[model samples]
Target: MANQGPKSQTILVVGGGIAGVTAAIEAAETGYDVILLERGPALGGRVAQLNRYFPKLCHPTCGLEINFQRIRKLKNLRVVTMASVAGVKGEKGDYTVSVSVSPRYVNANCTACGACAEATDMEVDSPFNYGLSKTKAAYLPHEHAFPMRYVVAPSAIGTPEADKIKAACKYDAVDLEDKGEDFEVNCGAVIWATGWEPYDPEKLESYNYNLSADIVSNVQMERLANHDGPTGGKIVRPSNGEPVKKVAMIQCAGSRDLNHLPYCSRICCLGSLKHAVYVREQYEDAQVDIYYIDLRAHDKLEAFYQRVAADPQVNFVKSKPASIRIDEEGRPVLCGENTITRELYEAPYDLVVLATGMKPAASEGYVPDIAMEQDEYGFLVPSVEGDGGIIPAGVASGPLDVSMSVQSATAAALKAIQAVGPKS
Candidate 1:
């Protein structure tokens, strides 16, 4: 694929998250042929699973749907779901990407009818809910999946459940015999919009994440507050299903410590603050305690900090928690030294939430072998002069919130467009 020849005008984006979606749409609408590949069964990525965004507190569906519509209208853009880039060969404008695709087990003829779901009794952990609940073996990723198609877990491939699911489909969209395949796509430039994942809370040995049923991560807190979530939008204790009236929000959990990430995630402070709002808005008498080294609510976000602080029920404490212990009363007791008062505090609450940081998607399994430059925090940042043909966008470049990610994606689109040049 590399003859040192003039490169093709095709641009390939190897992620279908917000960043990938924005970059693809911008480049394609600007008149370049673009291909978007998602490793998951559907598009929308982490944004699809969010209850509401910070700052504005708006549902993520509206923004995602608008992007989906824009993509549908652009004939230059082609979306391929359940596909990932396995390898890359050549350099700059001349590159060949090896793409491996997984089977969805459901075909385009699918009307998204509920027949297959009704036929399956087998269930698996729902990744959409951060594994807080289980889902049918044959189920849609979520109500607002971009392609609106269903997927079958690999465990059901040769089981009787597979045959039952296929038989129940009236449109014959279920294809139990569909085998995954690997293919190649040649493109001039590649945009790495692969986003980040929540840092694993289990690694924070001091927090006791698994020891207490009510101690959860910030991402899980989003699900618990979601109407479609397992608890049906009520912030309740998973242990006894009791309403949560008093809560502790621990900021910088597993972040800014040499033992862990060692740098500020940049999003945790705002995310934890948003969690506090969700709790306050739900219950009139609910009390929220926020523990943090400092509130990094910079610029426009500082106003929001003041707005939340005005609430009498929400109290801010300056401290990095030393440890969490489930007392004899079954409450999570937080132990720490308050830097402000120079006092050691031991407080207990109905629920404990650890605001974990973001770990780059590239740092994880997604394109783990990509030869891109990363910052000290494992973000794929482009140099001032820029990488030749591979552009990094969104959290893939660095830790950023949704709005900042969109702006980064737009910048990446501009770079990719410049690399590929105009239609000849």
Candidate 2:
């Protein structure tokens, strides 16, 4: 029999979000060959899309830039974008994983010049903006994209628009013929850091997200407040470009509900609090009302909650809104029972942000076919005591905010190192 130990010490980290990036960087900096794969066109992940983080409210780009610098300095690490694992085979330290790479239709020779984007009139719903804006057929994923590369939408292929884009790239980086291809990566340890997606608010049915333009989800609120966002960092009404002075933040919109996620998302509370901060920072006279079954700020976050609560402009209401209705004047009216006061109330706001919970990326489909084990909630577990060389990092392990995800990613990187450590 072949010697049953790690075939190679190479570590493959799937998902190039904050967690995956941290795992890969940590392992590689520690003298390990690491492969970091991102299923998107860039590596910043959801955090990149945010205006700022909670607690300090620092711009996400600050952290991302530091991480990017670390990544650039690591010689043993290779970053791959637009790639996902279709399957994972073999055992700990001897794994062969199939990778499916989607076509970016842009080649490595390209400099991130705006000529291609300027040449195309065809526009697509900007996923980076969470459908709040549109972008040219050939566009950059975001300004802070790690590779700082451009992507050509599939719709632009096989047309005059494609030719225009190709001709526009003076360096000849546009590859219209670039169809996605599949390949394999051989590694000893695998870290799954697939992140989370926001729960759909429309399912609430009572929230009336579809009926009103002002009822925005918390993530979209992030975009709306971002300087690079569709509204150019202004917290304004979507229906009309009027400044927002009154806002309601609904917490646990889909979390801790037996009918919905059934667990505390752990981030929405802090996120909504941050949203309130954003509003207060933008409008000094803005009145912000936060509705929650119970406040979830724990440990260090308690201070943040306290500080925000101290703001007289910010009101913390103890209730789960029964439903939101649009008045004839296009105002979002929140109707709910105030559990604390035992009263029914209806309030109107120019903008209402829903703090929806997070749903795991692996919740439904496309988990790697390996010894990976999933919990009742679909978050990936160590296949077997993590000895099987499959370790789950960040939100892939459970619901975690940014800071916790980094710590979790570091722990998973250490575990991965041990899994491929010196042989017995």
Candidate 3:
């Protein structure tokens, strides 16, 4: 019998977040052809939106920049932004993947020049900031956007503003008629690293997320502390632009509840703790209160929990907030039972940060019809048989922090390489 093996050794990585980026780089550096796809206009995913991570509290962009540099230097790797997986077919070591690309309207001719932005008077809510701010219709994705190209919003298409944007570009980078294209690639293995999204706080009706702009989600808190964010790094009330004096961080806002995720997201506790640090660093007199069903700072993170607990200004309350109400003065008031004291309490704060948990991006329903299996929570599950056909990495496999996501990506890369490598 003739040998039937992988026709191509190329590996395809879907989702250009830290996980996808790491897998692509690791595989390409190991001398394998890799293609990285991102659904957005750029490569960086949720990690790019963060102010800083826990423990070290180090800036995310610094690490992303290094990875970006590695990507730029690797000739065996190709990055396709504004692209998504449409479908997948075939078996391990031999697969055909279909991809759909969205038009950026701006092409490789772009020089990161601000001329295109200066031309458009129309604006759109910036998704990078999670709609906390607006950007020009012809705008770059973010400050650290990989490829560093501008994008023309679809709303600007066929409008006079689009013409103005096209005319303003000196490099002819703007292509007003550029409709995106769909294509297929034959590869040996696939790595799924689509990452995650923040749980919608609006669904937590009792939290009254829409009742007051002063109430924000944990992801918004990250932007509130980011220098590139809406308030320019000021931890202020979104309603009136005033500094927050009294702050409340509610843990497990949408997780570990039968009505919601019903699983511990594992990052909420530490995230809220880091948020406490951001508040204290900005305002010394600020008093921050954390309310949780229970603190789950498991394993190595206990030290961080202990350090934050030591702060005299940061108080830990043993309770789960039942609802949030607005006062006559339009302030957000927390109403709930204090489990420790076994007493009902209502407390008003200048701002409330809901520690909303992570929801797998695959849950949004864009995943291709493939052999992968998703848990009830919507996280992709790797094959237990270790066929190495379709691998799940990073947050797509489960809820994981940045460091762990990288580790997951590395493992996925190795599995993909092994699956595609020449067999004896």
Candidate 4:
């Protein structure tokens, strides 16, 4: 019989977000061969969609660029995009993992020269922008994509536009007949870093999210504030191209309720605070009202809350809004009782931003049916006795900010290395 023990020192890092990328880098730098897989056409998951981080509010690209540079210099690390784990067989330190690779239709010959995008007039909702904007059928994932490769949308396949896109590429990089294939990776350890997704605002029935275009989710608000977003960094009424003077930011839109996410998302409060800053910086006369059940800012982040609270134009209401109703004039009105004041209040706003929470990717059926366990919230949980080589990192383990996710990834890397290292 073959020994079911540390036969290979290779580590497989799943998901290409900041957490997975960090784990791959840390493990590879420690002399372990690492295979990093991303389910999208390019790397940079949810972090790539954000406008900026909280508190310091620095651009996310700054850190991602440094990681990208490190990846280019590392010879032991290999990155495979448009791939996901299908299954796993065998025990810890001697596992064979089945993998599925989706067709990007654009091959390695891609120079990202923007020729294909220009050749096709077909447009599709851009997933990078959370569908807030439209992109050409043949387009790059984002400006800072690590591989810097373009993707041909499945919607464009089987159409005459596909031929145009292929013919326009000078290097003949577009592969119209390219079909995805499945393979297997032999590794001693696995790191699951699949991140979180925004809680759907449409689930909040009383919010009237579907009835009005002015009611936007927290993630959508990020895109709206982004320079490459649909509105060109201008916060406006999505119903019409009018500037927003009065904005209502609702905290815990789909979180901390019996019907929705029962636990605090940890980042919604800070995100909403950052959104307030985005509005206050753009429009001089903008009045921002922040409605919340309670603020969850703690530790070093308390100072950022204080800074935004100091703005006289920003108002904080200690209330959980009951519902949003549109008036005959098409204005959104908020109705709720103030827990502190014990009085009912009704207010109107040009735009309502719902601060949605994070839902683990595992909850959405993205995780494979492996030996790994999950908590009640569907976040991956490590075995109590440390019996397996599969480890969870970043938001895959729990809800965390960018800084916390990096810390989790670093710890996971150490654990993975120990799993495949020489047994003491």
Candidate 5:
């Protein structure tokens, strides 16, 4: 593709999620100049937040490492993290875009050293750690994270540690004076793959997610299951840190409900099932139960479901738990009617995981002036006209698995390339 000569075409990809990353890689491979913007500190997006992906059941780092390598090798692709698209001008074949990038203190020169961390006494709840763990003022996002650099949380740095960190950095990469900058770029096409954020469980007061310690979201479950997780990969009751003997997965926590997200987040069901298996593997004595309206596994996913179900430790209950409450001893109690039995009953467990759904990241006031269409749910809808000016992929368009997200990203890249048109 390099033999086609340098085509002065540019495509701007918004969001650093799996879809955005895939689109950038594919477009750059096809010889189009690609620019990727991410609102987070790094480019892995929500995919990076996940523990093990389904289908292949591979750790996210396994696949993301390969993409990170590709990004390192692709000289034409430029990624701007901790950045946001401020505005847009022009249209179609040519557009002028302005972006605002926040200061991360440390930069590419960062060697992921613990020096800054050692010098700082400030501690904050790590959102990247799913709120289960804490990190120092200066810390890497995670072990084996791309860019392999420490990011200084300016907000978390207190006055004393802030000054200490400034003095501790040996490479002079720490730039507390580095304010955010805005710049413009010219692009022929744009891709919207901002991806989704987990639905806030506080909306469902019935689950008492914020009030109860044992009630956690699927994302939190991933952190609990990861070897480097809060509990060192031990599935335990959050209330007492006791090894959990019984676990329950509540599917459609914020999804498939008319009151919240009316659409079925396609991945939650399978994701919960996969976590169920993880729980069983960790605790042989653990009895795992999944409460759902339906299995909802599509295509080849049913095969994995069958394999997991046959494991004998998992039980599928076809009823949504109406309420989750803590018992006198701090155990989780699920109250709901079993559709098969047509009887109201309560099942007690040591842990309860809400298989929450995904919602558009743009809901939090992150959209730029690209003039694209979104569904009623705010998911970006790709143009059917094949004009190639705008591209949409991944959960930002709708809920989809990682495999499907990657495939959609490839399609979006092709569309972006075609939008550049053939050189005369």
Candidate 6:
């Protein structure tokens, strides 16, 4: 697949998460042809769902803007969203890839207008909104979403509503007949940056998350806290429209347990603490309690932890919540033994948030012929020599904070460039 006498080689970066995006950008800037494949409809990965990143409290859009601009200007980089790597062939220097792309009804002509959304009758629970809100069949994934285009869910739109949407769009960006296509590309190396998913709380029956309205996960809390959220940034009890007065944050809900995920997720403790601070900020009078077996705050995170603890409105309890049940009025009652006090107590709260652990993304199963290793926890195993043709980065490799994820991604890109050597 060498182009000529002396030129850069091609690299494929799978999974358009932060790590994948960084790898593609770095490789492309080094004069290599880079193909970025994302299973989702857009880039930015899990980080996109987050409202503000920790340490600096930077907005998600702020961090993503640089990469978006770089990708737009780079001629050697091609981003294919709604696509997955189906299979692979050949060796490291020259590999053949089969990419499967999904259909997005809208194209580059989309103007981010709300006309199609206003005309559509279908309403589906928005995954981007974390199920806290509803979106029409023709919807933009999120505010400040990349490509700044709206996509239509064919399954969500009926034939009648679909016709109306086509009529509503003044720009003919809606491609009604666009079907998914598959193609092959030749690349010298591959980078596996597939990210993680939140541990399903339904597996933890003791919390009764699926059955209770007030009990929610950290991700759901994000949606609740977002100004563009379903409730317009109101922290209210799901059972009623009343404001949440008391909030309880549970740490390590699905992590650090031998029966579940054996290793510490590394980010849960700090994430819970961050959410606790968020709750207090949302309701100045709200009493916030954080229950945890151990508060594992690494590096500079301890400073943030100390600041939150110094807040008079916050309570830090060292204990793992044994059970959670709802009261008559839909308040959450948390039962656990306070390890320090050695006393069992049941406290009622207007709302409860479980800091769930991360798992491999659904796209992990679609990885091509790469024989990459994964830990028992389903996280992708990193290469020992740091020279694996497939480089793992970000949350896909393990639990890491936003800054750490970005650092790891840059390192992965360097390794990919090393693998490709001096091009052809």
In order, candidate lDDTs are 0.88, 0.90, 0.91, 0.90, 0.83, 0.81
lDDT for predicted candidate 3 compared with the true structure: 0.91
Worst 10 residues of 2 by lDDT: 1-10
Q: Deviation in angstroms for 31 in model 6?
A: 1.9
Q: What's model 5's overall lDDT?
A: 0.83
Error of 1 at 103 (Å): 1.7
Per-candidate RMSD, Å:
2.2, 2.4, 2.5, 2.3, 2.6, 2.3
Off by over 4 Å in 6: 1-8, 362-364, 369-371, 382-387
- Candidate 6 positional error at 279, Å: 1.5
Error of 6 at 317 (Å): 1.2
- Each model's TM-score? 0.96, 0.97, 0.97, 0.97, 0.95, 0.94
Q: List the residue pairs that clash in candidate 2.
A: 93-188
C-alpha lDDT of residue 183 in model 4: 93
Query: Lowest-lDDT window of 10 residues in candidate 3?
Result: 1-10
Measured on C-alpha atoms, candidate 1 has an lDDT of 0.88
Reference-based lDDT, residue 194, model 5: 82
Report the lDDT tens digits of candidate 6 across residue range 90-170: 656667788888888888889998899999888878978777778998899888777688888868545787888888999
lDDT of 2 by residue, 287-392 (tens): 9999999999989999999999999999989999999999989999999999989999999999999999889999865786566788888788866544568888
Could you give candidate 4's per-residue lDDT for residues 305-336 as a string of tens digits?
Answer: 99999999999999989999998878899999
- Candidate 2 segments exceeding 4 Å error: 1-6
TM-score of candidate 2 on Cα atoms, chains taken together: 0.97
lDDT of 3 by residue, 1-424 (tens): 1222457788899999999999999998988889999999998799999999998899999999999999999988999999998888887778888898988999999998889999888999988888888999999898879989999999999999999999999999999989999998888889999999999999999999999999999999999999999999999999999889999999999999989989999999999999999999999899999999999988999999999999999999999899999999899999999998899999999999999999999998576546578889999986465466788999999989888999999999998888887532
